[model samples]
Target: MDDLFRGKHHVKVDGKGRVSVPPGFRRALEAADPNCGPERNATVYIAHWDGEPFLTCMTVRGMQEMTEQVRAMHPGDPDREALEEFLYENVEELRLDDTHRITMPKHLRDAAGLEGEMIFGGRGDRFRIYSPDVPKPAVSRLAQQMSTRPAGTSPFALLPDRPRPPAPGPRPGE
Candidate 1:
């Protein structure tokens, strides 16, 4: 969840609602690890859009893994078919043009109501597209939300301490 993109770039949406995916962000997608091969191709998954008036782009890897896991749980059940369709249908396969711009299709643009000014933020393995017209909540307000958690709210914190819990001790019968 902490996969927030560190690179920031300001860009505008054209009259057609198409916005360029800054080269820096494209590079961010190409290299999941900062120090890796210079591959340029990246898999992109355009979700239906979420989080109050914003569109979210998830890494193709993230989307595939999530879909596969969910599908596996249901076996041959038809219930998962709908989810599979939803993910694939909404996902927009993307590519960088000669100018290194990742085009946003008209349908997606319309879905998110993007017009002129927009904000792009790296969201872990994917990215988020937001209309600049919308006002974002102040960081201080977010900090306050984080500060109000219950004391033992964490699962890991509730686990009993195993004071050295008997070592391997020669596996069963040494």
Candidate 2:
């Protein structure tokens, strides 16, 4: 399976508005952006949803893909401008320092209501940092569903496993 951002981590927000990125997440970011190394800082784009108490973060490559999608829209389309404004105006580029942490800007911290502690949940190519008060029933529900799937029907069944043949059954005249 491809390397994916997947996990839930709790991190403390310091008085200075800095939060350390989980180590595993740092590795994932490095994997997503191969150009990043010890000397080169990895870039992350953060966007806070209006009226929502969370901030979505993605690698520079992911943000570039989103920008390309918006650029594909017709120039005269009104929605295109709105999307461009919403994305370009609200997004902030954060560079992970040597300590693997970034200072959250005041606007983003206020939008997400971040304070003492926050939850960082990975979602495929992106991740979200949410206040501790945010409800997480959806994640639990997904876990339940995955656990209940019948054998051999898991989405990950294509991964390498012990080879098996079809069960034999009576055929022809019996």
Candidate 3:
């Protein structure tokens, strides 16, 4: 929980599609990948699903967690097959260089229209890379709505309520 990917970064893409990975994100990636050390560069999995305008990037452990989830489903099930495809296909494994940059493949760059300045927005365990020219994501609108809610309201309210313990029994005096 302490190593969550947080904040946003704006970086430029070079002709060869190499871009600097933010230091904070690099640390998180290193923490998630047990194989990473002074002798090894962190390996990241980049996933671009469908025609989405951004590439989803995560550490090896993150990808493994996704794979495990998909694997839990029944074999040959329609949804399971789709999930397997989602986890296994359309992904590129990239390793960070000593300079802390990753050279994204041309196809991945083209699929996301990634060029010029890119927005690397953190999404907890993973991050998304996209061009700044595109329309704002729908979640941004939800963020705007957040301001209207009461000051103490938390976004976690959107999730199902956690179970509560039973009230304590009354004392003998009652």
lDDT at 17, model 1? 54
Clashing pairs in 3: none
lDDT of candidate 1 over 43-161, digit per residue (tens): 45566634446666765456667777776867666767767776767667775555556677877776666777777866556677766665555212333554576754654544678
| lDDT of the candidates, in the order given | 0.62, 0.81, 0.85
Give the TM-score ranking, best first.
Answer: 3, 2, 1
Inter-residue clash pairs, candidate 2: none
For each candidate in turn, the TM-score is 0.63, 0.76, 0.81
**Model 3, residue 64: C-alpha shift (Å):** 1.0
lDDT string, candidate 3, 98-154, tens digits: 999999999998888887778888899988888888677532544766677888788
Top-down lDDT ranking: 3, 2, 1
Model 2, 1-174: lDDT tens per residue? Answer: 133677899999999999999877777777767668878977788997687668888887788788898899999899999988978898998888888998998889888888889888888898888888866643344555556777557667546688798568976675
Q: Give the residue spans of candidate 2 off by over 4 A.
A: 1-3, 137-174
Model 2 / residue 73 / CA error / Å: 1.6
Task: Give the lowest summed-lDDT range of ten residues in model 3.
Answer: 137-146
TM-score of 1: 0.63
TM-score of model 2 vs. true structure: 0.76
